[model samples]
Target: MSLTHLPSLHRPASHGAGVRHKAQSMLHWGLSQGLPNVVVKMAARKGDLQGLLTQAGSGDEIWEVIDQVRAQGPLVKGRVTFITADHAVVSEVLTSKAFRTGNPLDRLGFLATASIRLRPDTMHPLVEPSLLVTEPPDHTRYRKLVTRVFTMRAVEKLRDRAETVARELLDELEGRVDLVEQYCSLLPVTLISQILGIPTSERRNVLAMGSDIAASLDFGLSWPEYRDVDAGLRRFDAWQEAHIETLRKNPGDDLLSQLVHVQDEDGTLDMAELKATAGLVLAAGFETTVNLLGNGIKLLHDNPEELSKLQQDPALWPNAVEEVLRIDPPVLLTARFAPEPTTLEGQYISAGLQVVVLLAGANRDPHVFEDPTRFDVTRANARDHLSFSAGRHHCLGAALARMEGEVGLKSFFDRYPDVTLLPGAQRRPTRILRGWRTLPAQV
Candidate 1:
């Protein structure tokens, strides 16, 4: 189908006047976030797992909450959702047909639901048409088309390029640097940009947009914060539309260009699906790897013995990436909803109820991994982490992220074996997506 023949894309309505915009923002914050925050905080005071998760700021803090959840049982009831930290239960929820991806506000009562429905122009990665929340047969179709473009062989082709970029990035480093900014973020963004055929000149803008849009995943965003996130999404959507048009005229060998032309018996993707898939690929393509690289660097630096082992036996680099993911994952948690009444691990879940799976906690389940808290590069089951999630909704860029982590971390450590992590490293202040905001290191 011709690009013009496809369905018209839905763009978010322009921001209203100052007073109106402020009022809308306040309404959105109160119903969609403010009220929910109040409830979760109340639960947190009572030592509830769901509330503790919202309050968790660091890896240590989150793990403490996870331990409390685990102690409760396989499935624990929370104020708004069902919470699970057990590895078996988490795995089941992610893979089962009984559960499906859901919005956080689904169970936040009538006001929250009505608030979302009132905003028809809302756009975010978690919204439908984006593969993150899309269900089959649409999801099945989208995944098939996207997978064809991101095949293992396609990712492997970028390996040599990734290594080259890592080497250049490291070579340019001098005494002190914020590795998160200078190295970790650059490596993956550059690779993902190339994958999407984004021009070098536009990459910095794209990175900034992705960073802002990422706030959509977090809950309880303040009025200004939500406004900024909405603006970023709109900017990205506009740019993506223009870029798709450009590719239609002058297609290249990039995965995105391939996606533009990909077809099957179901025909082709409409403009909305195209934008959603492409936008997701661009954002998710780099976000996880950026975190993995930052987290891996800190994890290895703290665990000198593991670093020494990797230096002694280079073959362990792959498993070292897995170990980092298990011990300090990029994504802390994800939620699944019961489309209908369902039983999981003998716990009956009412229809429309949400299940928040603590992936970081599940990765460290004592039943699944021995000494779950310890960082072991050689741990045989390290790859079994739910960091990239699992089952049908598993991260599409897992292989690419793993490749980037292995190549990026190995290259950095191999070059500066005596690298020292300086003080003042700060973790990103996000609860769901975890990583360093600034990781200063001296080589």
Candidate 2:
């Protein structure tokens, strides 16, 4: 349906009376481990000018678990508290102006709690904690260097190689193969390794280790799990440091070498910044694209007509990719720190108090996205989705991701025009990134 014809959240449900009632609100849920947490409701539920969202206190695992508990509720009309900003907050958070203000991620605490939930650590225990999770100056310095190498110019050059990677992976698929494991997961990792000059032999080991570290942030890990993740980080860092050392003496064409050797007259990146940038690019490039391809394919499975349209005219692949990212983004919500006591949505977020912006919720805000829930490929603003985030923290690898998705999807349909989802396509267990750890489908 056209966005204008799409139903609003408040529109009476097509179902029988009483079926349209919203889900439970101001949820009070608890974690099995310890304390209890209460979710504050957001004014976005009511489409207020100021986006007011309720957040559970970060007192302990209780809050983290509470968010996890809330994540389980219906994706639509989930019980919510005003602590987190709702759709009322999308324009501010996702607009380019937000980033130009400088250090938007840290300034707003975009989704710190979510980050904490993913990996509850006082310090950044993970290697190269995303610029999304870091403060500016701290984030900006490194981000600048990474962008230079990962720019559209550079990423476009890798298109053919990415296609080869996709093709080679698809050729190896067998009956009921996990599209994610065999195709999606493996493709980006290998691609990133190639970009960074890492050998293919180490891709699996690095990816597994990366997964362990990334997984520690979700569902709240135990002390031992945390330690194990930390250990894995050390190993990855040590290995990267060694590799970086090798490049310093004998630089190559890989992305890492570019960062190491590329210099502005003023000197743009430092060693620490270099390592952090390289690590983040490799991890984010691989992980985000992996989820994007898997999710895009899954979306095709869900919307066959859309798939058919794309199959008929691969040109739609670009728009289809945008629609997919918007509708089913890999990263859902992000937490930002309030740099100062700011008033938004008629609510005061005190300085240092963390504010998490629900991108998933904001993307579905009827005001910005006409019929925010209904999936529409031709929607003029479908690309406006916060999947890449906006402002200073907009995804650095977005261009690369887009090119990869466009090429990956186009190549897939060209190769197997009749491809269809198997009876079941696995979904990633966590809510942070929406994807399949395993997708068993046949062409």
Clashes of each: 0, 32
Q: List per-prediction Cα lDDT, in the order shown.
A: 0.85, 0.61
Candidate 2: tens digits of C-alpha lDDT, residues 132-211: 55656666666766776568888888898998988887787665666777777787788788888887788898888677
lDDT of 2: 0.61
Best by TM-score: 1
- Give the residue spans of candidate 2 off by over 4 A: 1-88, 94-130, 216-219, 262-271
State TM-scores per candidate. 0.93, 0.73
Predicted candidate 1 versus true structure: per-residue lDDT over 254-318, tens digit per residue: 98888888788888777888898998887668999999999999999999999999999999999
The residue pairs found clashing in candidate 1 are none
